[model samples]
Target: MLEVTLEILRFFVLALALGLFIHADRSVSYGRRGFLLIKIGFLLILFGVFMEITDQLDIPGWGMVADVHVNFYLAKVVGQLAGSVLLLVGLWFWLPSIRTMDEVQEALDRARSELEEHFVARTRELEAEVDRRCKAEAEGRISDERRRILFENSPIGITHGFVGGRFVERNRAYARMLGYDSPEEMAQAQALAGDTFSHIVDPADVERIVGQARNEDYVKDLIVRMRRKDGEIRWIRLEMAMARDHHGRNYYFYAFALDVTERKERSEALERYKRRLKGIFDSLPVGIFVVDRETHTMAWANPEALRMSGYTLDQMIGLPCREALCGDASFCPWGGIEEGVPCTDESFLTRKDGTRLPVLKNMVSTVVDGRESLVVSLQDISEQKRLEELREDVNRIVTHDLKGPIIGVINGCRLLLLEEESLDAELSEMLHLIENQAEKALQMIGLSLALYKIEAGTFTYEPEPVAVMDVVRETLVNLGGRIEDKRLAVSVLLDGGPDPGLGSPMIPANPLLLETMVANLLLNAVEAAPEGGEVSVGLEQGDPVVLTMVNAGAVPEALRETFFEKYSTGGKPGGTGLGTYSARLAAGAMGGTVELSVSDDEDRTTLRVTLPGA
Candidate 1:
């Protein structure tokens, strides 16, 4: 009986272990549901352990017989203790598995929810981007359509072609201008072919056109007679230019042409009229040059005019009138005439070789091409000018040579009267006045003689190697009395060194002319300076020798333009105005220049004289 009971207990324990193993498999496969199975299995294992303990102690018959006397109470206590331990262990393992199953299920649920939300949000963003791209494409298409319409409807003829000479596109104006019903038809007609376009050109002009277009990138105002679709020939002026492609291949040429048949006929008629009008221009015998006032260039020149100026039509076409004819630094000597004042008989022109040509010019302002222009005609009066100069020279010689002797006679008579002890007081006064008038006349004669000599290019110059410093010192000493009399201070600054060379030590120039020029400058400075004002003189040697004089007075604005002109002064009382002019002329004869400049601030005037080094 004990053996049977022990086997039955062992069988129940083995069945419980099998059930727990099944429960653990279910826990892994079925999540929270499997954990409930594990809890049920744990309870059954506890029951099986109790049954085994009862059987071992023989407390109750469980279909087994006892084989030997056993302590029922002690065995029952020991079996109950073992059952409690097994039940506790199984419960501990089952509880932790159940908790692990719960955590895994919670994590899976959260991940599923987050993934679905992310998928929905991404779909919406993609849809919005697609919509934006579609809208932008639609707007771009509309703008392109409008531009195409404008291009087709424009007034100017437009065409585009490939580098291979094939027409890619053209507009309605181009078709109509070329007498085609449509641009496509005109492009298909293939009008431009190997030099056939030259058929419209005159035989004599064909070579010129082809050569010009080949050598130059553009041709303008090319008049040609082209045949129309209706078999009419019309003169056209074509302006054409070449174009290149991205690959630098020669592309089709583009041209704008105007039907100039009427204009050409009118121009021919005008030529005939001009031939009739030629008599009027040629009859004057004097040269006539018509200058376009707006361009300041020559428009037309007569035969005699070209001869006088020594310029061909090709050389003269675009040249400024003053530059072509007059070599003067300033253009148009009749100043106010350029400002719409009619000019007549005052301005002089220069020749090709820098010679002055006297002319009687008549200018009248007129409007041409909606702009101001001058109609100028010139009459050459070079012969007349020469005759007048000759007369003046003769008169000067007669007056200057005769006046000195006359003055001597008057002075002797005055001295004789003063020596008479019985002479009346009024008589002595009259004699003194006569002597004064005679002296004035003699001075004028001397000035006239000097001017005549200068004009004739007969003034004598004696060049000698003299100490430049000595010459300057002497000039200063001679002017010391005048400087004191005028109450003006004179200062000289000289760079002292061995005279550079025979040419360096002293310049090749007339001593008298140099001294006269220096004296004139000093006198002018003295007159211009206020009482007790300062005057400065400086001498320096470089590539060229330079002498400078500065005075503490401003140049009057009125006299600035004509400062070096003969007989022009700022109206200072008793001022001859010839001193500065003659001084500059004398300097120029010696290959030197005398320049007068006012300070930028207009506070002082400076005179600079530059001469060739010795």
Candidate 2:
């Protein structure tokens, strides 16, 4: 029993050692070769123990046999011996490793102690940093509160959100601006679209504004059209900045917006108006220029003005008007005068080639962009001046050259008339008519100069009593050939009655002028009258005497307005067009006016002349 007890005790000790080895193996790593060797050694030791335990058991037939028992004992001894050898070998292999583990453990304990000390010190420093950060956070919160108040109450719209994402926060102004009742409503809509404000923005504008934001990370005063909640379109100007995280990654976008619909509309309207005005000015034949009042520089010049001044728009802008336009500054009507004064002048302008050009200039002061300015309108009058000079030359030739020959003819006719007694009645009458016709030619030559003077507003008037009946009689006699060719029925009336004797119901006018005027009317009447057409002249005596000449053929509709104007005529071959013009001028010179009226249904034209009565 004691032996058995000893064996049991031995087995227990071996088992306990195996348990300790397993515990150690779990806590520390044994190299693969060492682990395998130790494992085999321990298994052999357990096998020896198992054999010894078996030897103690009084069991079956095998152990009861002597040979079996001896074999078992031998096995037990071999197992123990092999186990002892293997354990020693394993220990040999594992000892250095165990020593290394022990040293590593010692070093680890020392490092752990140092780490604890450092952790304690670091905790204290962290506590101080936390305290400082907490104080700073408190101050920051107060400032943030004030900023929040301002952001919420600001008149301008403010919004914060992820770019291309739903809004995280929005100010009241932003909500109200978009016609939303509250910020939450706007946010709800934004979330539905999963975008910042693209749903409200015009599609084209969204692409442009968002593209700009992505490229620049900032947008300033970008105007976009956005639809409000109620479907109204509004113009919004956005100024935005994108926020980035520490790693320069996009975080969110914050934006300021203002409703600029009214201002934008006004600006657009003004731009359109400017475009139209520029079109008109460019189309005008007259040159228009705008000059600054304070700087005396060219503010604006129409296309015609630029062309006339021989300068490009780029070259003329902001240049002094004197240099750009009329070389002499003294010609500027606004010079040396208070702003807003107006003036007109006929002056000479210096062209780019240093040639003189006559211009009729009208200048008026105006205000532009809160600054006083001058608006100058000019017409090129070179053609008119040339025509006036030509007219003067013609008048000189008629007075000096033609009059001499005409006077000599009149003297020759007078000499012939003195010898009329030797001639028969027909010869004598023919001489008298020749003298009368020659005098008329001289009178007509003088009338040409008189008509020019009347047109120039330099004619002097001298009125005398003139017999209207005698003048009418003489005009009819002069136009007898034309009247006969047209087969016209001509008649003269006094106060709607038949023509009376000569010198009755006379008018105050030049006798020669009256005769010339009457002759022009009769000629026009005879020409206008159709074959066998009637021409009637009616005179009325009142405060102002009235002469009405009626003929067939109504005036053409297109020519009626300008019929009395100089060089205006229609449908008459070889017509000088100056007959009616001269007739009107002669009437005006004698305090008279002429008007034309047409009766389309009656197919007639009436020429009415009003002259001062005697």
Candidate 3:
């Protein structure tokens, strides 16, 4: 009974220690360093209890004391080692908080030291200055030297020229701004409207400046053009005030001058660019309309916009964009485009004559009426769309009409290929080539028609349970000649299952469309495979059916990104670039997606199609 009670106490101590350790560092959630250190220290103290229990009780598998080789002595040593490590790691993580506290203490100490020194130095200077000031006042000495030094060293251009005529004194900066070598030369020259001031651009500007300074005793930021010492004209600003004696008799005019050439040029350039942009806006091909962001009502419309909506300048000035072009508000993007977000969409505009016009619309935040607003641009593509539809129509008609003749040609080639045993080797090979080419042409036409259906949004889809291997087999048989020509090793892998439907991968898809996608996949693999390399086709049916094709020949580096994009067939010989593109569209039509990747380093290309599982 005493042993049982001791074992229970040991177990409880170990459990409590583990609980503390688990809750010690909540840094990932909620944590306190001081509490964590204390928890770890307590855990170390209880670890010996676990070591003592190792002799009485054996833990199950996958635990610290579960091993048969781990007895009481080993457990005690391990417990000490692990406890030490845990305690160290916990202390390590807690040091940053201690350092933070210490750093604040150090900063406070330095701040106190600096404040004490500042006070002492200020007190000493005040005491010394008071004594010096008393001595100087008793000696009857005036501080005229400080005033003279400040006047000469001031960065601002200061002058003390007589009110109406000759110059008296000037600073170096004032003389330099006036295109003179020094203050002496400027002071020697007369301050009237002659050689001393030949740099001033206009006599009226001078009159205005003198008038403002004389009447108001102060003038600020009076801009004028002046010639520099190097004969270059530059802009300058003047701020001045008149000085008078105690009797109110004018003595001299004090002024400061600053170089303002760069600021002037930038202002002028911005104004000119704005004017030029305004002119270009009217002539732009795209329709531009500025509207109030809150109301979405057009405040201004450029000429092209007015023409696009078939509205005159006066008519479109204040109309809501919907009322002006769309006749309704349904086509608008939204309240307005927010900053950094542009809205792009295709919408139809209703003309005045009740005809609908297709337009590509773009809207973004822009400034209008001196406030934040929306700028909407519309590009008319109705003619381009009409032409595209017409071209597709022509293609559909041509492919539809040529089907019979093409099938007859294929049948004839197949018939000729059958007589290869009775013909010469060259003749037999030619016949085989004819059959292969004919079959490929038939596949191209069928794919083209299928793609046209996808684009026209009229593709018919009747999905039923389909054995994927059946279509893959048919595609392999159809491409036998091409496969033989390339001498490629091919394999088809299917997952093993008891049920026939599960054994052979099956998907819910249109049989004809599935066959077409498979045909394209097989044909592309055959073309990509090296002359005598290997190709593999794999299928797996589950929640989603995946069909994979891998070829030994690498896909070109240039075509990887646009492998499924239309008209992107560059660098591949005898390639229309439409095969993969059409396959993707066909797969999408059947609720599937086609993904492709190529590894030039491995000399392998892979294509995968995922379809809805049956």
lDDT of each: 0.68, 0.81, 0.75
Q: Model 1: runs farther than 4 Å from truth?
A: 1-290, 293-357, 360-369, 375-391, 394-396, 399-454, 457-462, 466-482, 496-506, 600-602
Maximum-lDDT candidate: 2
Task: Order the numbered candidates by TM-score, best leading.
Answer: 3, 2, 1
Residue range 248-343, candidate 1, lDDT tens digits: 644556655666778889999999888877877766666677667667887767776766777776766666877754445565643456545666
Please give the distance, in angstroms, between residue 507's alpha carbon in candidate 1 and its true position after superposition.
3.7
User: By lDDT, is 2 or 3 better?
Assistant: 2
TM-score of each: 0.36, 0.47, 0.57
lDDT of 3 by residue, 115-226 (tens): 9999999999999999998989866534556657767888777766876555567788777876788887765554453554566778887778667756766778889887
The full ranking of all candidates by lDDT, starting with the best, is: 2, 3, 1
Worst 10 residues of 3 by lDDT: 496-505
Give Cα distance to truth, residue 451, candidate 1, Å: 5.3
